[model samples]
Target: MILYHTEPDSPVIEISVEGKITDHDLREAIERMRGDLELNGKTRVLERIEHFTGIEPKALWTDITLGVSVARKVTRAAVVADAVWIRASMHLARFFTKAEVKAFHVNELEQARVWINT
Candidate 1:
């Protein structure tokens, strides 16, 4: 499951991923994000992966497509995660985004928010 919320004070869009994240979740998230990007002009993305366990290859592909779409539109991307693999993946993928990608621990969500807002 995925839930999306917009930051009240900024153009940052936050997404929460819980339970199983399927390709459908990725697609829906991307669609909402695209709408947000168009509305915000200068966009930022915050993604929180809390109860998300694993993603399938189709989901991964969707993720890449969404990331690329965000890269073309957003000013920054912040990801808060406890999963080591996800952190590593973000670090590796950072180079592709036009926006900066920063990964933080769940406890550092505030810090991630600061970075994205900045």
Candidate 2:
């Protein structure tokens, strides 16, 4: 499941993920961020992984495609997760994205927020 918290008139989008993520969830989130980027010109993202069990193969593909499509429009991204694999994946994803992507341990969420906002 994916939950979005977008402030009105703000260029920053916050998303929380829980359980297994489906393709539909990823697509919807991408659309939402795209809308924000269209309106704000650019966007920063803060993703909090609460309990990510895994993502479906199709969802993973969709995520990659959509993310690359909007990479240049995203200025920064901060992913907060407890899992080492998740952090590693975020690091790897940075290579494919135009955004300045960073990973933070769950305990460093506040720092992530500050970094993304800056």
Candidate 3:
């Protein structure tokens, strides 16, 4: 499931993801994110992943497409998770996009939020 904590007035897109994700979930999330990007021009993101088991390949494709479309518009992104693979993936993302992507341990969720907001 994808739980969004987005504030309409804020430029930050805050979301929490758990369990397996479907294309519907991903598409909905990305659509909201796109709206934010359109409104703000530049955006920041805070994603907290917990017990995330998997995601459909189609959802991955959708995420990739939509993410690439908004990549240049994202100024910063904070990913909060304890998974090593997720953090490693965030590190890899730095090379592909201009955004300053940071990964924090789950315990540092507040720190991540502060960094992203600043």
All candidates: TM-score: 0.83, 0.90, 0.91
Candidate 1: clashing pairs of residues = none
User: What's the lDDT for all of these models?
Assistant: 0.81, 0.88, 0.86
Q: Return the candidate ranking by TM-score, descending.
A: 3, 2, 1
Candidate 3 lDDT tens digits, 15-113:
899999999998988788888888877789898998889999999898787857776678898999878889878868765578999999899999999
Model 3 regions lying over 4 Å from their true place = none
TM-score winner between 1 and 3, please give it.
Answer: 3
Candidate 1 residue spans exceeding 4 A from truth: 65-67
Candidate 1 vs candidate 3, lDDT winner: 3
Pick the winner on TM-score between candidates 2 and 3.
3
lDDT of 2 by residue, 15-113 (tens): 999999999998998888888899998899899997779899999999787867876678899999978888888867756777889999999999999
Question: Which candidate number has the best TM-score?
Answer: 3
User: What's the lDDT of the predicted structure labeled candidate 3?
Assistant: 0.86
RMSD of each: 2.1, 1.4, 1.3
